[model samples]
Target: RVIEITLTSPMPDFLRLLAQPEMGIFLDGSGAGPMVRSDESDGQPLLLTPLPPEARGFPAREQWQSRARQVAVSAMPANSAVDAFAAGEVDLVLNGRLSNLPLADTGPLTRGTIRLDAALGVFGLVVRSDDGFLAEPLNRQALSLAVDRSNLLQPFNVGGWQSTSWIVPRELANGAAAQGERWPNLSFEQRRDIARQRVAAWERAEGEELVLRIGLPDGPGSDTLFTQLAGNFTQVGITAVRAGLREGAELELHDRLARFYSPRWFLNQFHCRLELGLCSEEADDLVEQSIVESDAQLKAQFLATAHNQLIDSEIFIPLGAPVRWSLVRGNITGFEENRWGLHPLFPLSQPPT
Candidate 1:
């Protein structure tokens, strides 16, 4: 039977629905449903595909037949969406945060049903370069070293996360820094030792204790991270007070996701000449050079230099990569783990006959 199903929404809603199997759309593979025709939505275009052979036995098959495997996709927030998935009201939860998956392993559901993709984005700390005493590169490096990047993922209850030492994750570089070029290369013990000496020296020179305030957005993730960092900073004799959502705080934690493989997006965020007042002339020069460079190899080289310069300055302390977990049920297939953190919707559907 030829089935024509169309499901679409605004950009975000469309992307979310596109990621779920119930929509009969997959990004990476030819969907189980052969698409006959598609109508463009105001946002992303909608795809029309036939139902999978396996779905012929679905309990709700009757409801979907009216439109030939058509499935209703509603815009749902994170919590409600997850709850619906667990209750079997939905077949999948797309692009869900790992922290929200704790209940996924509860009575009715188990961890096995969850899929995690540690997107190429980074979770890290941002320091104001113009801020007093704390703005010093040595001081910033000490503070950065004091943090235990592993603890950043402790509250998520998921594993397979990696601690990063560079602002851009290696995956974004296409493995160019895989051999340790991007990493700061200091062991935690060595960092801790250096941090202690640096902080003590700074305090000795300034004739005062090294105290700093940390700012973070309001959320469970921020709360957990702040606590962990505060403890780590204490070990190095730096007093870190939770500043709580304050704008322009001396140090702030942040998360940035790359929409595509471009160094500009990552580099622009820290450009000193930008409004953030976090500037480094050398870093800025490299960034400007990289953007204008015509040669592909030279562009990459300039960008890498800029990235390394930023790391040496330690203005941004790389913590851990952001994690995303999804829950999938049924015989649907075609979900592949990707480094870009993208879950293609076209590839998700019933296995081919």
Candidate 2:
């Protein structure tokens, strides 16, 4: 008999590819499955579907129950799904966010958890080139130096999470240096100072107010973090507008916005772009070379150059990295951790005995 599984995300192109005949897995969500009339049923072979994008607004627990036969809600916020898993109403609970393991083991009901990726996502600042004040590399660098990354992470309880070196996380690279080791000597304060001096130099070249528009996501902690960053900007006499989710897309679309935007910004978990409307002829050439370069060393050099240019230009301000965690049941086999914090669930050849 085929082992059926359910997934909990809006069906993307990749997931659809995984559900093909050659893939040999049956995947669906509660929305596509037959309506269940009862709370409990004898264990049966069925493919439950994952969560839909529209369902993200629903409570996490409700979302979980809508997908798996058993809900193993891990470090995600406590919700009805977690309560159901704790009460032994579900078969398996998978934690989506950073795991919040209980101090006391709940026996067989509780499963083991692991950190899948050291850095899951990133947050940073972007400037608008059209603003005219950030036309020079020194101007951009000054903005970068003004940010206190350590202080930014303090409220989030992630003080140790340092700034990233590459456009993507180190783990994602095939043979590149880890982001942590690239610049060990530069302290947070030093980086800020560098940015200040750069900005001052730019002012000498062309006198203009270094006004900036900062776009942030509309979720929890976004507003608070940006507010803190604004204080840091003020210290350097840079005028900053704390734009929230409302202004993000418009900022991205504005062609002149690249002056302030980092090409290597993380839009979401799956989407990361190196250029956000800022066009540098040299940077674009290097990006193209990096993508096609077959030699490992050459590719690394190209990527490094691009990274440095962006930094030197102060195109974007490096913020703290985001953390993501996944939890698995003890009986579940073949669930290896990945750099992306994702696990392969398709090759489910066996069920927990």
Candidate lDDT scores, in order, read 0.67, 0.48
lDDT of 1 at 335: 73
Error of 1 at 332 (Å): 4.2
What residue runs in model 2 are displaced by over 4 Å at the alpha carbon? 1-116, 120-122, 165-210, 246-275, 290-296, 325-337, 344-353
lDDT (Cα) of model 1: 0.67
Candidate 2 TM-score to native:
0.53
What candidate 1 gets wrong by more than 4 Å, as runs, is: 1-68, 75-77, 98-107, 150-157, 171-178, 181-186, 204-209, 243-248, 262-265, 272-277, 331-334, 344-353
lDDT of 2 by residue, 1-353 (tens): 34565754222344544533345433462222222223434553344334433453444453444334422223334344455555655434443332232311233443343333444454465554535555555555566567665566565553246555444455543233353643468876676677677666656766776666666644345556656777888877776776754464222211111111122222111112444534445655675676567676776677566655544555555554544444344566556654344444432323443
Q: Give the number of the best model, judged by TM-score.
A: 1
lDDT for model 2, on a 0 to 1 scale? 0.48
Supply candidate 2's per-residue lDDT for 218.
44
- Residue range 158-227, candidate 1, lDDT tens digits: 6788887777766555334545533357677888999899889878888998788888765455566677
> Model 2 residue 143 lDDT?
60
